[model samples]
Target: MGLERVIPVAEKLGVTRPEAKVLTVAGTNGKGSTTTTLAAILAAQGYQVGLYQSPHIYRFNERVKINGIEVDDQVLVEAFVRVDQARRDCQLSLSFFEATSLAAFLIFQQQQCDVWVLEVGLGGRLDVVNVIDPDVAVITNIGIDHVEWIGDTIEKIAFEKAGIIRPNIPVIFAGQQALPKAIQDKAQACQATLYAVNRDYFYQDADDGQHWNFASSGSTLRLPLGHLALDNIAAAIAAIQVSGLDVSEQALVTGIRNARLAGRFDVRQIAGKTVIFDAGHNPHGVEFLLKNLQKFMKNHDQYTEILSIFSMLGDKDINSVVKLLKGCILKWKIAELNVPRAASLAELNSALHTENNVEQFENIKAAFESALAEVKDNQIILVCGSFHTLEAIWECLEEWQ
Candidate 1:
């Protein structure tokens, strides 16, 4: 199917959208995390939840899951068949993203999901997923990404993300974005109950290293996840409370600790080194990941060297992302990601700034090999920059070991 076919078919399918409550997520970086967190929280509360995310690094089925299990391949294929046939009559074009978005929505309808957590694939206003009106809308930390499709300024982008907030819906944001008042006006126009971080709910890391304190208008609980995750956790908890699900603080803490969303700072063992992976596409996310990685490294002992395996698409703010991770990256093994929009080696080099300690590889596997050959025992080998880089290395690591 094509982008044109995505909407009409989705609109037709939505006419019979199954008996399911909806919680929509729209943002720049934290959409997947917040969606996964809410899915886990609701699943722990004994509700059958369906989650839909985008830009899967590993598999197409990663986009749709129920209670953390990827929807069966058979189910996905059949749903795709229906959507394909539906579009055949119209002969409409559908992008890869559009087709997958519609298929997943249809699958959610087929399954009797108690709650559906949907993340906008791109800008909220025109995104295929926006065809579904979400009950509880949550925007997590709006930042600059998709500048061309959305807008140039943060306020313009926020306006688009804020489009998901429907009338009378209580929209819980992770924090007040550094955007113009136009964004606030748009949310007010939609009649969404805006609750920014530190306003409707507040979080403070306790002086003790054990736990962090999270307080909302409804309730407060000391969370198990660290500060980096509190914003996401708090957003999930706030949305759950607004949903009136009666999920307990114990469930929140347990779910937060147990929540393991892949491709988000996923750490694994490879060739006796700390193989860290994060799919931080844009600069904002890269900044956050670098900050967390530094803190994590500082808190740990016996780290020898930092080797980075990096690649990115042509579209991203590659320079900023690379610069953020470059200072401490003792060595760089640049490679090509197996993706259509991959940035060439020359483009990747622009981010390196200094010419020293950099090497080029045919692909991510080659880069990983180079890094592995040189790294010390127990040293960190971070495979980051883009999902394509991490995804390629992730697949290769299975065969390497």
Candidate 2:
């Protein structure tokens, strides 16, 4: 019954996908932001919500939250126990993501929650979380990531993320590309209603190309969502509207202003100089990071330096990552992460040697120190490319303190 038990219990329980009013989110990026935003809007509307996300920053409890508070460990343990008792011996080789997903499903079933925001782990269709039939399905910005399981091309990848769309449910999509077309095709095959940008609904950034837009029902607004952040906002808004959650234009405005998905271009100050931390590993996410950074820095026409600190899992394309970030970055802090999957310093060096301003380090702490030593106070330090990198930096900060 420990949190570790998940195999047979899940099978024994018969894949009991809850019949909750679910809002399942699947995409290459922005899943967290879109899910969290929907949960926040519902909570603001007084709905008891269960939000499940992935790859905890610090604690396992982060995957399950009720009303913005992570489920207590005791609750998690009890859910695991129930799953363990159900399985009893029918061994299912569940990954940690698979096990935790089942536990969350069971917990949501037991609770009287009004809505559940399910975050997809990998591909949408076969992901353990996909067992449930969602009421409102959302696909936010498709791209090429997780190739081993999801396939290679963006089209193949779209098929996987599109798996979140359930029959008869209303689906909202972003990322104006053929991927949305793939989702629409799947939705049509399932007889699901599809509303999308440039068709059913769309979003435009206000503040002269910086606000969000949701052009649904043939109307648009100067999306007052400022903070240099717009991650699947259009799709989220469309989903909310389709789900029959009545919120004024005011709530959307408020939520966008208040919503914050941690570790996605989140800005902070370690010792007064500006720093941005984003777990954007793949080329798609990197492209966005570079674009948004470039867009935001447009006013500072003066050559602003980029101090890029990075570490990543070995499976990721370190070379592609280097190529994507090469020109934009002013300097590089190539550090090795502690996790088993982390890319080695040697691998990073080989990837970046052809690029400019690149340096190697034993690990994250040293890289951070060296970057700090060389960068000017006005320059910005962007820590990115892996969640493990952020976790390591956080741990280092704790140790230093």
Q: Each candidate's TM vs. the true structure?
A: 0.94, 0.90
Q: Please list the residue runs of candidate 2 whose C-alpha ends up more than 4 Å from where it truly belongs after superposition.
A: 1-19, 89-93, 179-181, 208-211, 218-222, 226-231, 299-303, 399-401
Count the clashes in each prediction.
6, 8
| All-Cα superposition RMSD per candidate | 2.1, 3.4
Alpha carbon deviation, residue 382, candidate 1 (Å):
0.8
lDDT of each: 0.79, 0.76
- lDDT per residue for candidate 2 within 1-401, as digits (tens), equals 12234434564675455555789998887788788888776776777889999878767787898878888988899988776656556654556676688788777767778788888888787787777778898888787777888889877888888887877889887776644567768999999988776777766655565455556683565667644346476667788888976677776777667666668777777765667888888887787778778865785554388898888889998788778888878888887888888888788888887776777788888888777667785588889989888877776665433
lDDT of 1 by residue, 1-401 (tens): 11355667666556235568889988888888888899888888788888999878778788899988899889999988988877776677677777787888788777878888898888787777777778888888778777878888878888787877778877888855543465478668888777778778888778876788878766667777633356787788888888756687777876787677777878777777678888888887887688778767877767856888888888899877876777788888898777788999889888785758898988888889888888887578888888788788767667667
